[model samples]
Structure formats: structure tokens, C-alpha cells
Target: MKSLATLRAVSAPALAFVAGFMHAWAIASPLGGQPVWWLQLMALTLLVILLDRCRSATAAAWLGSLFATCSIGGSVWWLYISLHVYGGLSSAMAGLSVLGLSGFLAVYYALAGAVFCRLRPRGPAFRSCLFAAVWLAADLLRATLLTGFPWGVGGYAHIDGPFSALAPWVGVYGIGAAAAFVSALLAAVLVRPAQICGAWQPLLVVVLVVVALGRSHEAQDLERAPAVSVTLLQANIAQEQKFESATGVRDALEWYATQLMAASTALVVAPETAIPLLPDQLPAGYLEKLRSHFATGQRAALIGIPMGRIVEGYTNSVVGLGPGADEYRYDKHHLVPFGEFVPPLFRWFTRMIKIPLGDFESGAVGQSSFQWSGNRFAPNICYEDLFGEELAARFRDKAYAPTVLVNVSNIAWFGNTVAIDQHLQISRMRAREFERPMLRATNTGATAVIDRFGRVTDLLPRHTRGALVAQVQGSKLITAYAWWLSRLGLWPFWVLVAAVLTVAGRASRE
Candidate 1:
């Protein structure tokens, strides 16, 4: 009996780690395929079951933290490749950096677990709802605080699942919250057979949510603009040699210049930093020649190039060329931490790595979209699409809302990993949320056209040098997500979480 009890104690922490690992696979399976939504729900359900059995709030918190550390660490383990193999950080330092980030993010979940244990409600239904609310609050905080690295939220798992229908109405967080509630309910059923009589209420809520978000939220036809012929360039430059002037830089400049001059599409796009140097830094007449060619006729090109100098501030910017396209510039507003800008007290850390052009000036939030061929093209840099709320800001003005979403990225820093598949899914989520077709131009992979329905209509194979020439249709009508997120921001979700938690607290006291 003593040995059995000892075995139980050891198994709990191991089980938590396993649950978190499973959660990571559910987000973007490391096995290299689409996310399985059921797997994610089951993983969270297991965590909830474990939490319910914890004797103390502190114990639950520790278990939750361990689970989250494993989940987040497993999800973004590719960061180590960028840090050690590419950024020149030592293997030990790279491993610690990834662990540090994962642990820091796990704090949110730790708090949630503690709160759930402390405010344990009597009824299974109310208790499950409370757990869901607390989990969602943690997710919201993670997505908002510290520049928001919400890479592998639970909702991403459901992009191709049943709950995906909820995306246009409540967005990713809402879907995740619903999944949490269901996970807790499943846990309640297994862990609390005595509370089986109270299951109807939670089950009813789930039914209502499904009926409301799924049935009422059917896809309606949006105003369709004329199709635009776009040529998306994917140069597939190696991250190590991307900035080298003699090899990667020279080849990119020559190849892109040749392609730009030869393309007949109405809109032509190159991946981010396709020209890794400034205009003046080019070998003379390089910028002017392309501009002069695109200056006339209806054909236009949106090329990614850096602007400004070291003395002032350089920007990761895109310049539009062609008749009505010139004079149009869109600077990247959302910058990546460590890669684009070092955080406070992190200057020492950054100096140890070798990321070039690590610092950049940020652009305004409401920059105008590039207008060409009667379609407004909203541009987002690498990982910018991860924040759907920021993109919703443009929907504040229906007249000027982006007809097409354009993403230019160079995620070669992480090499050939699930990051490509994950990023493609992120872009697809944006396409689903805003009901706007997404056009992606990447340096290495997932260069494709996603329809407003979030389906990949055209795709170029990863790690290949090619151009994706396709006809893309732009949408005019806004999704419910765009409409509300633009008007009220994340306040609705904040209010939902607050109200649920308040009710749960009052019930616990009763």
C-alpha cells in the first residue's frame, strides 16, 4: 500500500507533462499533419481531471504550470533552431531561452489552476463553467501582455474542426473558451459521478452555443470585387546567406528584378525583404529602374525593401510601384521581440546573438491599404496575422476596409519546420475571421492564396523557388468578428470572462 501511494504521487507530475505534450501536438502536430481537435479537447480534459483531484490549490497550480510549460515548450521548440543554429547562441543558452519563455507564459495557467481550486463550485456544471472562464482569462492575458506571443492557442486546433464555425462570431479566444468548458465537462463526468444529475445545465449551454454559433452563423455571400491576377514570388533564400551582399542579396536582386520586369499580372508581390538592402545601398539605378518600369500602365508591384538608415531608424517596409501604386508605403507596425526589437534589460542578451537589422521603427496602426485594380490590399508582415484584433482595426471604416489581405514573410530563420504549416494556418484563421481572401508571399514556404472561407486555393511547395500565379477574389462584406472586434475591441470577451467569474465566485460562496 505504501508503494502504491508513492507510485501515485510520481505519476501525477508525469501525467501532467504528458497532457501538455499532447496539447502541443493538438495545436500543430509535430508529427507533421493537421491538428486533431478531439486530441486537444481530450488533453485539456485530462488536465482538468488531474486538477480536480489535487488536494490543495498550490499543488494544482504547480501541476498546471508543469503542464503549460510542456505544452508551450513543445509547441515552439523550433525557436531553439533559430537561436542556436542561426543566431549563433550556444546550445545550452538556446535551450534555456526556450524554457525561460515557456515557463514565463505558463504563469498565467498557474494562476488559473489556483483560482479554480480555491473557488471550487458545488455543482459540476457551475464548476466546469468556472474552470472554462478562468482558463480563457489566462489565454486572454497571455495574448495581450508582453507584446502577446499567442502562437499556439487551443482554438487553432479547431480551424478545420466543428468549432471553426464559431470563428466569425466569437473569434479564437471564444472557441478556445468553449473548448475548455467542454473539456471540463468531460472531466466532470469522469471524475464526479455523484454530480451526474447536474450535467444537463452545462450540456444545454454547449448545445445552445453550437446552435447559435453554428446554425445562425452560416456563411453568407459577400460583395465580390473583380478578380485580380497576382504573381506571388517565393525566392526560398537561405537564412544564413540572406543578407550576404555577394551571394544571396545579389542573386535575389537580380532574380526578383528580372521576374518583376517580365510578369504580366495586374499585381506582383515579392516576399518580405526580397531586397535586403536600402535603395542607396543598391548598385546604382536598381530602385529607379524598377520604379520607372512599374510607373506606367495598370500593372503594379508591391516589393519588400528596407527604408531609412542606421543614424536615424530603419523600417521593414514595402514600397508600391506602378501608376497609382507609387508613393504608397506600408511599414510593419507589429514587430517581433528579440528579432526586431530587444526588450528592457535584454540588450545584453541580444548582443550575444547575431540577428541583423534587429532594431526597426514601427509604423502607424491605421496605415492605408494599397489601392490597385479596384481592390484595397491590406499588408501584414511576418506573424502580424497572428493578432486578428489588430487587423480588425481596419474594419472600423467599411469603405476602406481591406478587400484583400496580403502577407509577406521570410520565416527562413526557423528553417524547414512546422512553423511553415503553423503560419499558413494562422493566415487561414485571419482569412476566416475577416472574410477576406489572404495572399501570402514567403521566402521559403506556404506561399499561397487562401479564399475568404479560409481554404487554400493555390499553394507553392515549401523550400522551392517559384512564383504562385493565381486569380484571387477580394471580399467587400465584413464578418461578424470584424464588425464587433473593430467596434468594441476585446471588451466583449473581457466582459464575458468577468461576468462568468463573478457568478462562479458568488456560487462558490453560496
Candidate 2:
């Protein structure tokens, strides 16, 4: 009996670690394909099992923290490549930095576990609902506080699974909540048979969710325009040489200009910073020549260029260069910490690197989408596509909401890792949320067109220099997720969390 108890104790922690590690693997790409989503549910079930077995809130918190540490550490290990390879940080320091970030970020989940243990219900259904609500609150907080990093959330695992159908209706966090609820319900069924009767409520919620998704009007009877021809230029500019005036800058100018002048399409989009210079700073006659060429015809050129004068501060911006297009510019609203703009007191840390163009001003949020021949193009720069709520905010005014989405990125900083595929997942989620086609142009990779259903219809292989030519139809209908998020922000989610906890407390008392 003693040996049996010892074995149980040892296996629980081991399972916790395995669960976290498997969760990490489930979201990993090019290494673990999207179909490993089942592993995520299994991992969460194991974590819930561990939490349920713990005698105290503190123990549950520690277990949750351990699981999160393993998961996040595994998922973001590639950050070592970015910092050491590109940012010039020492390998030891870069590695320690990643470990430190994972440890710190895991606390959100730890807090959720701690809170759930303290106020858990005797009835498994209420407890499961409480767990789901608390888990979502943690995720929502992680994605909100300190500019938010919501990568590797469980909902992302469902990108190709049944939970995906909920994306257009509830967004990633909502999908994540549903996933957590289901995972906890599975744990309840396995660990505590007495509570099985409570399962019907969550099951009914699932039924309603499915019926709602089935009856969704987001994709029905929307105006479909004739496919527009788009040419995405992926110049494959090496990050180290992109700004050097000697060869890198000059070569990009010559190469991209040559391609643009040669192409005939309704819209021609270049990856972020393809111009590498502001409007007033372009080499003499270079900007004028491209403008002159694009002015004579129906073709329009939308390229990423730095915008603003020396005194006002420059923005990482994309400007429309051709005639009837020059007035429109989309400045990046979400600036990447350490990459675009160093956070307060972190300037000293940024000084350790040799990267250029690290300091940039932020653009106003909700700027008007660039109006193309009847279709509005909303542009988001690198890392901005990670925020679905920010993107959803643009849908409040449907009349002015973008019909097509455009994202331009320069992922060469991470260099030839799964970061490319992970970024592609982020874009696909956005495509589903708004039911809009995402047109992409990238400096290094993932240049493609995502249709309304978030499927990649056309793609250019990563680390290759090529242009992708494809036709895409615009979407006019706003999804249910977009409609709610644009108006309520994340208030509904917080309210749901509160309600679940309140009901769980009453059930436990009863």
C-alpha cells in the first residue's frame, strides 16, 4: 500500500511534466503538424487531474507553474536563435532570457490554478466550468497585461480541428475557453464518477455552440467581387544587410523596382520595409520614377516604406506610391518591444544589439483602410496580426470595415525556424475571425493569400526569393466574433469568468 501511494505521487508530477511538454509539442510546427491537437486536450486533462489531486491551493499553483514552465520553455526555445543569432546576445544570456520569460509568463496559469483550488465546487460540472472560466481569465490576462503575448494558447491547437468552427463565432480565447471546459469535463468523468450527472449542462452548452455555428450567417449571402489579381513581392532581403547603404539597400531598391515595373496586376504589394527609406528620403528620382510608371495605368503599387520627417519621429509604415494611391498610408500601430521600440529602461538592453531601425513611433489605431478599386485594403505590419481583438475592432463600422486584409512582414530576424509557420497560423486565425481574405507579402517567407475560411490558397516557399501571383475575392460580412469584440472589447469574457466563479462558489456551499 505504501509503495502504491509512492508510485501514485511520483507518476503524478511526471505526468504533469509530460503533459506540459506534450502541450508544447502540439502547438509546434514543421516539427509537430497541426493534427496533434488531440495532444493538447490530453495534456490539459492531465494538468486538471493533477490539480484535482492536490490538497492545497499552493500545491496546485506550483503544479500549474511547473506545467507552464515546461510548455512555454519548449515552445519558445527558438527565441534563443533570434537573440543570439541576430540580436548579438551571448548564447548563455539569450538562453537564460528565454527561461526567465517562460518562468515569468507561467505565473498567470499558476494563479488560475491557485484560485480554482480555493473556490472549487463539489459538483464536477460547476468545478469544470469554473476551471474553464479561470483558465480563460488567465489567458486573457496574459494576452492583455504588458502588451500581451497570447502565443501557443490551447485554442490555437484547434486551428484545424472542430474548435476551429468556433473561431469565427468566439475568437481564439473563446475557443480556448470551450476547449478548457471540455478538457476539465473529461477529467471529471475519469476521476470522479459521482459528479457525472452535472456533465449535461456543459454538454448542452456544446450543443448550443454547434447549432449556433451551424446557423452562422457570417458566410452567407455576402457580396463577392470578381477576383482581383495581386502580386506579392518577397525579396528575401537578409536582415543584416537590409539597411546597409552600400549594397543591401541599393540592391533591394533595384530588384523590387524592376519587379514592380515589370508586373501588371490590379494590386502590387511589397513586404514591410521594402523601400527601406521614408518618402522624403528616397534616393533622387527613384521614388518619382516608380510613381510616374504606376500613374499612367490601372495598376497600383502599395509598398512598405518608413514615413515621417526627422523631427516628428518616423513610423514603420506602408505607403501607397502609385497615382490615386499616394495619400493612403497605414502606419504600424503595434510596435514590437526590443525589435521596433525598446520599452522603458530597456534601452540599455537594446543597446547591446547592432540592429538598425529599432526605434519607431506608433501609428494611430483604427486608421482608415486603403481603398482600392472598390475593395478596401486594411494593412497590418509585422507582429500586429497576432492581436485578433485589435483586428476585430476595425469591424464596428461595417460600412468602412476592410473587405480584404493585408499583412506585410519581415521575419528574417528569427531566420529559418518554425517562427515562420507559427506566424502563418496567427494570420490564418485572423482570416477566420473576420471572414476576410488576408493578402500577405513578406521579406523572408510565408507570402501567401488566405481565403475567407482561413485556408492558404496560394503560398511562396520560405527563404525563397519570388513573387506570388493569385486572385482573391473580398468578404463583406462581419463574423459574429468580430461583431461582439468590436463593441464589447473583452468585457463579455471577463463577465463570463466572474459568473462561473460565482456559481461555483454557491454550488460548493450547497
Candidate 3:
């Protein structure tokens, strides 16, 4: 038999690498459109098994940190495409950048793992619940603290699985909690004979949930008769050429304006930063010519344009261009850390790449909802739809809650990778949470329409330039998840996590 020290040293790193590899594949598109979800469960199960193997709190924390850093860093390896392939950065710098960011983000998981080890209970079931609670807490911190970057949450893997049914009632984080719980239970069963009784528990859940959610809710439940007619414009504008006024800018303005004139839909929306320049910087009569055409129409056109001046700074904004132009305007709220504004101390790193427009002002959280054709439309520029709570807040005032969610994104920066599909999954999750329709208009890819049940009713091909016209539904009903989370944000879920750990501790003492 192997020595105890030999097993301890060899097992942790091997487990970390295996978990990381599985986690990385869990979000890739090769396995499936939504990635392989079983891989995610497998990874989480391995992680819990490793944590349980850890003899000390310090070892557990270190193992968690190692797994997270490797897994997260590997999963977001696509950043290399953004930096080395597109941003003109060296491969070394791109790799280091992804690793640095992943390492920084892993601290939250590390802390949670440490707490779990320190407060570990006796029963495997209770311990599993405690592990899940801590994992959810870690994910919550990842999404909320420091302006939040909630990428690669395990809940995303289950978008196509039984956990999908839980979205309408619990939101993304709650699903994540459930995922972690199942993983912990499976991990215990993998090693302990005591857990054998419940070893097949997760399988039973999968069978029941798949059957329960088999109905096509998006098709039968959502209103299709009175669908809000929308025309979404995707310019296929190249990121490198977006700002060169002579070539990219001139062509984009003409193409979009012509598309706008031809469109007959009630609402027409262009992709994020489709204009590629500040309104003031555009050649005189350029905007006017388009405005003149759209100025006298029943159809309304919304264009993504950079507005404002250098003294006060610019804003990544969307404005209504056709009839009733004064009614609709949306400024992006969730600014990307390095892409939008240089993180407080990270200015030096960003100097390597030249992004056309950086450091724009953030729009207020409770910004005005655009009203058109008896439908309330809430616009989220870029990946702002990734945050479910931010969208849930609109449901607080049920009277004015957004009936439709519109996402305008220019994910060209990330290149034509799984980021497009990942973002689509994010919007789909939002639909389930709010029971509202999501219409996305993106610059490079994933231009699609998702329904109240998180189903993509229509989709445009990735990396292609064209219009995706769809009749979308508008919802007034706030899901049970939305109603509770709207008021206190993530606190209710946080409280539940704390309560679980508290109970576990009490039981351990008893």
C-alpha cells in the first residue's frame, strides 16, 4: 500500500488537474451547443472529493484555489484570441493575462473552501449541504463584489438539463447552489459506503426533472399572436476597421441606414456601438441624412452610438432615431473591467492595446424603460444581460417591469468562439427568471430571440452580417424567483446558505 504522505501529495494535484480539465470542457461548444453538462458535475464531484481528502483547513483552501485557478484559467483560454489574435498582443502576454485574472478570481473559492474545512460536520449529507452552501457563497461573491464578473458559474452547464426547470423559480445562483449540492452528494457517494444509499439519488433527480420539464413552455405558454414585431440589424463590422472613418465607418453608416429605411417592423435595433463613432465626430449631415429618412416614419430605429464629449467623458449609449425619438435612450451600466475602464491600478496593462472607445459613463440602474406599441422594453448593451438580479430589479414595480429584454452586444473582441453561445445561454437564463422575451442584436454573432421559457425561438448564424426579424412576446408575470430576489438582491439566498451551515454546525455539536 502507498504511504499516507505519498497519497496526500499525489492525489491533490491530480484531482485538481482532472477537475480543471473537465470544467474547461463543460463550457466548450464541441460537445454540444450548451456544452457537456455531465462534465461539470463530474468536475464538481472531483473537487468535493479532494476537499474531503484534505486533512487540514489550509490544505483544503490551497486545493480549492489550485483547482479554481487552473479550471477557470483554462476555461477562459479564449481570451488569447482577443489579445494575441485580435488585440495585437504577444501570446505570452495574453496567456499571462488570462492566468492573472483567473488567479485573482479564485481567491473567493479559496476562502469558501477554507471555511468549509474549518466548520466541517460529521454526516456526509450535512457535509455535502455545507459544501454546496459555501460554493454558492463563492459564486455570489464572484458576481457581486468589485463590479462583478460572474463568468463560468456551474449553473450554466445545466441550461439544457433538468436544472433548467429550476431557473424560473430560483434564478441562476440558485441553480448553481443546486448543482453544487448534487456534486457534493455524488462525491460523498463515490468514496463513502455510508453514502451508497443515496448514490443513485442524483440520477433519480435527473430522470424526474427531465420528464417534468419535457413540455415546451416557450411555445405553448408565451403569447405568439400579439408578438412584438422587431427587426434586429447585425452589421458584421470588423473590430479592427470599426473606427477607420474612410473605410469601415463610411460603409457601416450606409449599410445600417439603408437597412433601417427598408425595415417595416415596429422596432428596429442595431448592434452595440454600430455607429463606431461619437455623434459629434461624424461628418456633418451624416446622422442628419439618416435621421431625415427615419425622421418621418411610424417605425422607430434604435442605434448604438457613442455620445457626449471629452471634458465630461463619453457614454456607450443607444438612442431612438425615428418617430418619437425622445422616448428611448439606454446607457450601458455594467462596464467591462479592462475593456471599458481601466481598473483603478491596471492602467499600465491596458496601454498595450488601443480600444477605440474606453472609459465611458455608466447608466443608472433604474433607467427609463422604453415604451413602444404597448410593450415595455428594457435595453442592456453588451453582456449586461449576464446579471439576472440586475434584470430582476425591473420586476420590483410589477406595473412597469420590462415586458421584453433587449441585448445589444459587440462580442467581436472575444473573437468567434464559444463566447457567443455562452452569451446566448446567459440571455436564455434571464428569460426563465423573468418569464420575458429576449431579443439580441450583436455585431459578430449570436443574434437570436429567446422566449420566456429560455428557448431560442429564432437565431441568426454566427459571424454573418444580416437582419434577424422575429415576432417576440412580452410578459407581465414575475416569476417566484424574480419576486423575492427583486427586493433584497442576493441576500435571501445568502441567508439560506448561512442557515444551512448554521444548522450543520448545530448538528455536528449535538
Could you tell me which residue pairs clash in candidate 2?
Answer: none
Q: lDDT per residue, candidate 2, 1-510, as tens digits?
A: 999989977887788788888888777554633436688889998999899998899989988988988888877777887788888999899999889988888999999999889888766677788889989998898888888877777777777777788888888888888888888998998888766778767777886886678466543777765578899999998888888888779989999999988888889999999989777877889888888888877788789988887777899998775566346788999888787888888888898876777889998878888887778889999879988888777899989998999999998887887777778887888898788999989999889999988899999988899999999899888788889998998999999998888877776677
lDDT of 3 at 507: 71
Q: Return the top candidate by TM-score.
A: 1
What would the per-residue lDDT of candidate 1 be over residues 236-277, giving only the tens digit for each residue? 989989999888998899999999988999999998999999
C-alpha RMSD of each candidate structure in angstroms: 1.5, 2.0, 2.7
| Cα error of candidate 1 at position 238, Å | 0.5
Best-to-worst order by TM-score is 1, 2, 3
Candidate 3 regions exceeding 4 Å error are 2-8, 198-225, 325-327, 506-510
Superposed model 2: Cα runs more than 4 Å off: 1-9, 32-35, 193-197, 204-208, 309-311
Tens-place lDDT digits, model 3, residues 1-510: 569879879878888877976786676554555756788889989888888878888988898888888777766777788778776788898888888889898998898888888888856666777988999999999999999988778788777777777787677887788778778878777789677676566546645764564453333444332467899988888777777888888888888878978998988989898888787878788778867776675777778887788677888888776655464678888888777887888778788876657688888786767777778888888878888888777789878888888889998887777777878888888887778888899898789989887889998888888999889878877677788888888898889888987887777677
**What total of clashing residue pairs does each candidate reach?**
0, 0, 0
TM-score per candidate:
0.97, 0.95, 0.92
Candidate 2 backbone clash number: 0
Name the candidate that leads on lDDT. Answer: 1
